[model samples]
Target: MKLTIERAALLKSLAHVQSVVERRTTIPILSNVKLEGRSGRLSLNATDMDLDIAETVPADISQPGATTAPAHTFYDIVRKLPEGSQVEIEFKPDDGQMTLRSGRSKFSLSCLPVEDFPVLSGGEFPFSFTLTSSELKALIDRTRFAISTEETRYYLNGIYLHAATGSDGAMLRAVATDGHRLARAEVTMPEGASGMPGIIIPRKTVAEVRKLIDETDGEITVSLSETKLKFAFADAELTSKLIDGTFPDYERVIPTDNDKVLDVDCKSFAQAVDRVSAISTEKSRAIKLSIERGTATLSASSPESGSAVEEIEATYDSTPLEIGFNSRYLLDILSQVEGETARFAMADAASPTVVREVADSSAIYVLMPMRV
Candidate 1:
């Protein structure tokens, strides 16, 4: 394969595909990226057996052929080249080496047979839909922080994507939880997305797709089946294997009868929690919230570091209540609130507390109280 591509264009495509290659792999071919230069374009493909990314870019092709080469080394060579340089790539089958030339610098990367690379074929994605970049970003950002990192509950290690009918109309929802906290976000259900199977997209795949969304403002095409999911955005395509376990019924945990409401300025509440938590122990990270009719106080105490307390104005008319919550968890949920005020609905200090932005009903957060 012989092709000439701009250093900027080649580096951008390489950055996307090379991240899928593992730093250490037992199989030799898994360490290399499959490169195909044909039809005035160069296609770069890389996979770690479970997830795969393929990207294509315009290139000046002198010879049409395909080969495999080290993904990281090839990317590094092009990245260090001079700006605005034209990179010429050539592969000779007899020598089993791929050569890169730019300016006065030259690099030779060892090549492997293209046939040895594994292809993650997404067979027949019957359920397909499109989502704007902004919509997709909101869904991922609101829920991904609550995704479980525990290995035993493999099903909870990803976001649950499914279609549901609310009081307003049909909606597409993304829910994630780690037993201590839960986050749910939804958008207007797109046409052709009804009756789609509920799928648990792994954490790594969610992160990769989110990164791609930042590069374009155009609509993203999503295709999925029972076992696989594919995201096509910009000039790149990503395919990943879905988790093969059942997610728990999250509705059972969300409380609907919490009538006591407390509304506080998000910025002030978050700042107070951060200051008080400084005195709390590292392991517990616990902070106490004391809410009255029109005032709320946040306090934290540690045996070694003493105690701290701060009062913030709030709007609450219910019976006075005191609750203990993990300071870190509280701050994480607060960051998701886009509005100026955060509303918390609580039944008691022992029950789960529901939180949401005052102006946005599209997202909800639930936090479990802890002993102070």
Candidate 2:
């Protein structure tokens, strides 16, 4: 196969697909990217068994053929080439080798047969829908921080996406939790999403799809089956195997009868937690929130380090309440709040606290209290 492509365009596509290729692979062909040229375009595909990414770029097709080359090596070579330079790639049919030429630089790379590369089958996806880039980004950004890293509860390692009925009727919701904290966000459900089955999208796939969506403003087409899901954008398509497990029912954990309500500036609350947690111990990075009539004080103390206290004005009408929570969890939820103020609904020091954006009710966060 022989093709000529602009360096910038090739690099951009390679940068997107190569990330799916792991640094180390048990199978040699899995480490290489499949390059195919035909019909005036060149496509690059990389996969790590579970996740696969395919990206295409405009190119002059000199010969219609395909080959598999080292993903990282080819990316590195093209990345270092002079900007705006045209890249010529030629692969011999009989000999498994690829020659990359740019200006005066020429390198021959060993390649594997294109047939050896594994192709993730585009399984039967019965459910499909189109979502705006902005909406998809919001769902991911709000809930991804709470994904669990512990391998014991493998079901909680990804974001749970399902359809549910809210005050506004049917909605497409995404929820993630790590036992201590939970984040739930929703967007208006499209016509076809009303009875969609719940699916747990792996953490890595969530991150990759998020990156792909940020690169373009075009709408993303999502197709989901029982075992696999696919996301198709302008010039790229990502396929990932769904986690084979059930996500816990998250509704039971959300606090419903919390009577105490405290409204504080999201930025100020986050800053107070940041400053006070500086003196908190490594094992328990807890910050205590003491709310009274109209003020809130954040305090943190460690046996080895001194204590820190910061007071912020807030609108609180309930009786005085003191609660402790992980400083990092608080910061994560606060960062997702779009409005200036954050509403914290509390029942007691022992129960989970519900947090919501004061101006928007579509997103909610539940944080479990930690002992101080």
RMSD (Å) of each candidate, 1 decimal: 1.0, 0.9
lDDT of 1 by residue, 25-90 (tens): 999898999999999999999999889999999999999999999999888888899999999999
In candidate 2, what residue range of length 10 has the lowest lDDT sum? Answer: 188-197
TM-score per candidate:
0.98, 0.98
| 209-232: candidate 2 lDDT, tens digit per residue | 998988989889888988999999
Please list the C-alpha lDDT of all candidates, in the order they appear: 0.94, 0.93
**Alpha carbon deviation, residue 319, candidate 1 (Å):** 0.8
Off by over 4 Å in 1: none
